[model samples]
Target chain A: MVKRGAASCLLALALPAGAAEFNAALMVAPEVDTPNTASPYYVGPPLVPDRASRQDLELRLREGGFNVQETLRWQTIRDRTPEQHGIANQFYYDGELGDGLGWTAGKKLMSWGVGFGFKPLDVVQRENRRLVNRPALVGAPVLAVERFTADEAWTVAWTHPGRGEGSDDFRDASLALRWYRLSAGGDDLHAVARLSHRRGLEAGVGATRVIGEEWSIYGAALYERRTRRLMNMLVGNGGTLAAADPMSEQVGGGGTKAVAGAQWTGASGWSTLAEAWYDADAYSRAQWQRLDALTASQHALAGIAPAAAIAGNVAWSSQAYLTPNLLRENLLLRLGYDDRDGFRPYAELLATPRDGGRVWTIGAAFEGNRQRLALGLRQAGGADGSAYARAPIRRAAWAEWRLALF
Target chain B: MSRRLAALALAVALPASAAENVAALLKQADAFRLPAESVRVETQVELYKNGALDKERLYTVYVKPGRRSLVLMKSPSEIGQKVLMLADQFWLLMPESQRPLRITASQKLLGEASTGDIASMTWSEDYDGVVEDEVDCPVPPPNLPEATAPPKPRRCLHLDLAQARSGVTYARIELYLEKSIKLPIKADLYVGSGKRAKEAWYVPKPIEGQQRIMAMLLLDDIQPNRRTVVHYRSIVPKAAPDEFFNPAALVRNSLSGW
Candidate 1:
């Protein structure tokens, strides 16, 4: 139905003389990398010892007409590791009417998914490396694109994971609305409300008010009524079987949780965040009686565990321009400490993809009229006495270069 | 020493008469402002790229006050490409399907023919002076070769052609006025863009009982970086209907026949 409607609109526009414009680009990249020797992220099983590496060819095309634009991209790597050899293609179709009503439909990554908002798309950052867990349904048209005059915009979108065979087809979608406002030369209120299909519901609200031109004070609170099934899906079934379903056993039972955090931005290019969370999953009469001092306050920053856990984290990112066109450098560093004392397997699995322990990265990008080059190094390791006590640290580095053709 | 002082005073006083006369003439010319009502002109635009002729288009220009003017293509047997120049904006009505697309001021006007800025007709406001022909003289050198006979004596005057200066007329221009008639017979225009200067001849003829200059040409030999020659094949003043200059009128007349 949508395709037919779009076709008729194009026909109407073509009744008169039509103008066509085209733009195209081609790219070739060759890379070589070592094999992974540590335990894979999914399970504590032996990792794939060695994998072959190779390069690929990519092409992009854009066709613009009176009021429509169509873009298509193709990428294929013939000789890659067993896990990496897959064709990655994306098609984007967008049209803008004279009245400002525009539509976009294609196979692009949906950036509004759970735990996906703050992170770049997997293809862009190559976070997971493996391509089996990619989102389905390609891309769908859901809303109209328009310019906003307000200081901030809160966008919420929903998705469904489709149906399954044994399990009730994972029916889930997440709606998150975040407003990042700018005031007094600094960031202001940045509130996020996320409601997912699996998790009963959750709300996180944050507010930041500028105290000076270069400094701001901010606070955020999170409340959640996590569904029991959702926890089971994450922790997997715990058993002695060598190959049992990893998502069957859930530790934290269904319960209510309240977390509060405070962070200061513009702290000399460094931000310090402190948060405390309490879960009433293992409820006891005495736990409610000692709510005031035990469930909240500055003790969270002193490395004291709330009923669940409290953590203090510091993160910093800075960029330096070496020259106008010859060189540029970027650095990212994060360090955090959590108070608790058990090797929580579930936490090790979910927390890192979320809190993502300690990470440091250094990258440089260089470009000229003829050639371009970029190199990045990353090291992510966490020492969680409370979880994954023996998890090995992981590190990786990559570099890419391209030549321009006119 | 007193004799030298008297000579200096006479030299300084010589320009006083010319300045006063030029200022008075400007006052009189104010009433002769190009009628802001409407104009129908036959024009040709020659496009040049890298100092070579690329393409040329003959057009019929219909202009109106405070509204859009339409320039319809008439040459190369191409589709009727219409360009509309409104008061505050400009647009192109593509004849392919009569789509009205807003054009940027920096785009080439007609297939690289001229810069869009020159088509907006705002160039005339950049100059400020008025000089009249106070004497009859032959056409200047370097324009008409010495081997060619001087057509007739014309009244010529030295005018300040500086741009935007208090008494300047054109950025760079020189006028050779007809001795008896005050109309300009020839003009030399030195464009600021890095190109050779251009000279145009305005040969007048009586048409429909009104005196009009119908012949015009741009000489590109001076500046090899740009080249173009335009000839007015036909012109009909006040021939365009009143509705042709409207923005909506252009859209309405676009897909439909004239």
Candidate 2:
């Protein structure tokens, strides 16, 4: 059924009239994973996989105002069954409702903010920017009306309509409004607001200003009525182990997210970026310490309780590793160079200052006329007993080869 | 005594008259590149390394009266990319993220920084200078591609120009124009450090019974082996809507057929 539906969509995309563009890509990505054993949360053969690889074929077609993007993915993991699925990344139609007014319907990517590593004003699409082997973005279902002038634009969208809330914030039904204006001095100013039952009301403002010939700076801040995060119910209750997972999503009071960054690019092809951001949804230093103590107590019950139960509890506690940021405050620095021959290389370091946790990544990509190759490697480290230091995955490396078939 | 009196009169009025002449000359020269007040230019760029074809790209450029330009990348690899230029300010929007990013001045360098630089260039608005001398037009070096070179030799006016505004791509330009028609012939581009960066040649062809710049050849002085040939496939006098140039509108997939 998946293959049939995808093929039908591809045919539908090609049948459009008036200057249609059809492009297809064939890509193969193989990844190697190195799990850390010294950490208390490592799960070896049964639950967690040792390695994984994916092969993908993506098609994108655009005609007049209609656009469709669909990808077919097949994956293999060590000691696990192969998985296959079809993903519709973006499918939307944009048309003019009247003079200077526009309307867009269907699923589309609507990302807004002013940060590199983190974006505070992305109320409709809370994208995690640092994911390894980032997949194509799956747009939110929205019906948006927008208007633009020479220097100003405003958009009001009903996102995920009729679907109240799902697993995360991206699937929540909400009304989002974004107002953007280009200041007289060339500064970009933006204001965004989102209203939803899951999180009540959220609002933010952002600005980007270019300095001299080689520098640019930007900052943004968002206020939320509620922030939701998973917490261990028995962290301070002094429980050795539990028969079931104790982690559950809990809603907290109002919180704030902010990011500030500056970048400089030189004529010599070298560029540097320095950015820092605070995420109110992530765990704090004190909260990590308490979780660590709970995990230690669980390990002490290895002989008293069933080993499987103890292992499961520890794995449940490892959920902390899944958050976008390990701690609230993060600082990121990146240095990159474009050789001007379609090759670009960069090195980046992301550090959580409060807990001294760090992540180091290096990557390079070369793009030819119709082919692209990318390779990257990342490692986690920091002060002993820090959240990143005790993470399950210690290092990862991957490579991708993509060819455009038109 | 009459000749001496004429020379004295010339010396007293030269400064103000020269400024006006330079402005007029620049406007005349600009008409060759931009044939209309608002135009849509279909351009193709060919990159050559050591006289061998290395890569090719296609761009659709929309230019307006107020130094505003929007470039759409048409190559397969860069299908959804766009660059918006509003005078000294520039923004680049990549297809993957669909977010507009403010770009620094250095990132506006033609060919290397962004294609929008070369796609939209007008000297009358960005530079002010004085005509220095009249001399024979320089011939295109044999290494340049043929269709883009001037066909015959003629007297030329040598102009020395300095940047009149900040955030411009080049700080200085030594321009040479055909003395008779004031048509631009060659330009020596310079960087902020007084280093000659690239040499550019303008190629004019008859379009609609009038001579217009149909092609451009850019020879890199810094990288001796690199050369870029730009061909304007079509230039139509059509003005896009003002709202399309807004930076925030870059993400909308609605610019097609505009």
Candidate 3:
């Protein structure tokens, strides 16, 4: 049904207007990387592919105050492969309604916040899995209305979760409003408020200010009143057996997350950005230590007792202890140099200060007449019991080539 | 016979008449340029490296003087991309991102064209000019092709310019304007070290129905074999709403109809 609708829309757009524009690209990217050599306690997959391929077809159409975009991808890793499609990368109709009012409706990609590596106020589509090497963002459905002047704007939007295989519930929809202003000194200031049926209320403020000619500082902070599912481990039979359950808890008092950063660009096209992020909901140092101890106990039990019951308990415990974004404080630094001859060299370092773990990547991209090539190396480093030390893939080297087709 | 007094007297007396003449000349020259209040222009840029075509880009520019300007990219790879300049601040709005990202003036848009170069159109406001001297056109080089030959001994006015304020791209410039039309013919940009860094030539062409003239600017890096040519495809006298200069409005304007 979705495909049929898309085809009909494309036909209508292509046929009706003489001003319609069409664009398309075909990209085939293949990569080879080293195997993972981390501890067994790591939750993610241990062995990534030594070879993988991804081919993507992207198409866009614009006509009669409407725009539509689509992407189809086929990827293979070793012997396993999957086909994925995004019907509406961005399908929106926009027009002015006189009196400084404008409206846009359809599926679109939206990004909020001012951090290079992390954004706290970007709640919509926040759960989408992102790759560090490739930073494409998925789009969401929305209907937005805005009134704007040369330096100020007020906007309201109704947002819906992106189309995919997910549980459909009230939580998948939300209403958001934003007010933005530009100061005489060229500072961009914005305030956002969102209400979700399942998550209650969330509000945030963000600002970006240019300092002098070479420096800029930006930051975003959000406070949310929502319920979180926390893990609870129960010990029974005088501490000899254990079971894990998820407990729902309401967190409303000052549960905030913030990201602040600054950037500097030199006259020679060298730029650097440094950012720091704090997630109040993330695991603290003591909590991480406790989880680490529990994992170690499970590992010891699995090694010592090979019985079926013991193995099952260890597996369950391992699953229970797996957490996402476990660290509280993180710092990111990015540096890049573009010589404008199609050669760009860049590097990024992400450090979890609380756990003393870090992930560092260095890459270079070269653009040819009709193709692009990128080479990169990534490494995770930390002491024992740290997040990076337990990372599934500790080191990797990759190369990607993209040939443009139009 | 006090040297300081004499120097001060000369400095005060020399600029009164020269300044008046320069002001008149700059005002006349401004008439040949785009309207400073509000205007829309379509621009195409072609980059050449070592005399080979490197890249091409098209853009639609909307400007409101003393307020803000927006440059929207109209090309294959970056169709709905825009850059908004509010006062001294610059922001890049990509189609995939909801919020505009603050950027530096040094960032390149296409080839040697920086975002600063495309956003700014008024030169008389940023620079103060003094009439240097009058000179005849230089003789054509021996190896120059007939088609590339210099114009025959046309009267020209040479002017030296200095920055009226800080943060401009060039610290000093030497400009030559055709005396007849007050059209800029050539400009040599100098860096802080007083060394010529780039040379630009403005070639004027008439619009079909309009009295205004549009110019094609060719910029050459002082280092040999690097050049960028910017063609003013169209410059229409249209007044954009003040609301259009805002970053949010600029982003919204990039969708659909534009």
Q: DockQ of all candidates, in order?
A: 0.02, 0.57, 0.47
Model 2: per-residue lDDT, tens digit, B78-178?
A: 77889888888998898778888888877766234247445556798889876766678988988675443455668887788888988777898999988
Candidate 2 docking category? Answer: medium
Comparing chain B with the reference, what is the TM-score for each candidate? 0.58, 0.89, 0.79
Residue-level lDDT for B206 in candidate 1: 62
In candidate 3, what are the lDDT values of residues A1-406, reduced to their tens digit?
3574467446645555557777666666666655444544343322234667777666767776577777666677775656564455667777768768988887666566566777776766563221534534556788888898778998888887443322322236888788889877768888887777655688999998877667888999988776342332522222323543322232434467788999987666688989988777666677556655654665566656654444344345444223335576888899998776678899998888878888888999887654678888888777667766665557767766665454
lDDT by residue (B90-206, candidate 1, tens digit) is 446543233233343222222323423223222233444444324564443353321232565544443434355321112455544443333445557654442325655444556
lDDT for position B39 in model 1? 56
Question: lDDT order of candidates, best first?
Answer: 2, 3, 1
Model 3 whole-model lDDT (C-alpha atoms): 0.65
For model 2, the DockQ equals: 0.57
Output the TM-score of candidate 1.
0.35
What CAPRI-style quality would you assign to candidate 3? acceptable
- Of 2 and 3, the candidate ahead on lDDT is 2
**lDDT of each model, Cα atoms only?**
0.35, 0.84, 0.65
lDDT of 2 by residue, A1-406 (tens): 4775486466656575457887778888888878888888886755667678888888888888888878888988888899888887788899998767999998888989789999999888888898888877888989999999999999999999899876778998999999999999889999999999878999999999999888999999999999988999888676768778899898999999999999988877789999999999999999999998888888888788888888899889888888888889999999998877778899999998888888999999988777889999999989898888988889999888888776
The DockQ-based order of candidates, best leading, equals: 2, 3, 1
Q: Would you give me the overall lDDT of model 2?
A: 0.84
Report, for all candidates in order, the number of backbone clashes: 15, 0, 0
